[model samples]
Target: MKHYLRPEGSPPVNGYSHAVAFSGTSVAVSGQVPVDAEGRIVGEGDPEGQLRQVFVNLRTALAAAGAGMADIAKLTVFLTDLADLGAFRKVRDEFIDVERPPACSLVQVVGLVHPAFRVEIEALAVLPVESVQPG
Candidate 1:
């Protein structure tokens, strides 16, 4: 994957790239919330804890598709409050490569599917052709 961190005319980025280029089997991961496998909310009103669970869910979902966090090319994040941006970035860095971050878009929404959910993240990844297995 190629990360266009600072394109010629693009503005400086904080923790994401302007764009990403990759050739492989495309994998689309649905939006993930801060719920565990049992559907129980992991964090109540804490942004850090909520973001952590979201990342964990993303990892599990990616693995099921034969991909990992490093395979991700882009991310779409939704937060009920923009104030959680700091916690979001802190937790996100734990899962994604900081040096070659994926293209990302963050949106502040009024609320998520569940009122208890503070954040939701969706990812787009590319798995190398050789990594794809016959099913």
Candidate 2:
């Protein structure tokens, strides 16, 4: 079963939920962009800056679902340029501290929502039983 998350005072949704709550032992978060805590785009013209922002964004999303980087099972990264991949990997390690990191995949894409944006990361996590809290 799946439940949508829409906290009070949050903006209206067009056709998608900010996240979905599931009944399994783990929770999974969808792709998160470089949008900041206030929902504004970050690192407008820089790939490295944008990559860091993506991590921040993912952390925020994971927290909302009662999960964290340690619980992540996989991360799929889409990039506009292959040359910028090293920077993205460096930034990713900074946020994820587990010795055995989650599975990861990188893909080169022509473009994203905005041309200035060079990266986007989507994550899937397994919510440990200990991490789940009763609402």
Candidate 3:
């Protein structure tokens, strides 16, 4: 995948690229947030609940991108509280298998979208070429 700024006239990218392109049979998705169906916050102040919601959102985003958990190669998480490690692992292991789990990263961030939010996650995936359509 090639990550690039949208374009000069396009909105500026702070640290992340405005767009990413995939030429291989796989796609890697960034960690998704815990926004709900109405695009509102869920699991306020609850790391475990919030992490679960992050997974759900990631699945939805991957589906829209023509991928799934089995296609994932890596999963990275960002959290506001390092003390939530236990909770994080509990939630992380739920969806991922031990045999060949994707590479993972967990970082402690100063803050997130809202002060109440405790976690956010992103992923790297490898979808079958036949399943991918160029964006």
Clashing pairs in 2: 26-127
Is candidate 1 or 3 superior in lDDT?
Answer: 1
TM for every model, in the order presented, reads: 0.98, 0.75, 0.74
lDDT of each residue in 32-105, candidate 3, tens digit only? 88788898888887878888889888888888888876566766789899998888788767776544456566
- Give one clash count per candidate, in the order shown: 0, 1, 5
Q: Give lDDT: candidate 3, residue 40.
A: 86
Root-mean-square deviation of candidate 3: 10.0
Best by TM-score: 1
In model 2, which regions exceed 4 Å deviation? 1-24
Please tell me which model should have the higher TM-score, number 2 or number 3.
2
Global CA lDDT of candidate 3, please? 0.73
Off by over 4 Å in 1: none
Cα-lDDT of candidate 1 = 0.96
Task: For model 1, name the residue pairs that clash.
Answer: none
Q: After superposition, how far is residue 130 of candidate 2 from its true place, in Å?
A: 3.2
Model 3: pairs clashing at backbone N, Cα or C within 3 Å? 26-127, 28-125, 30-122, 31-121, 31-122
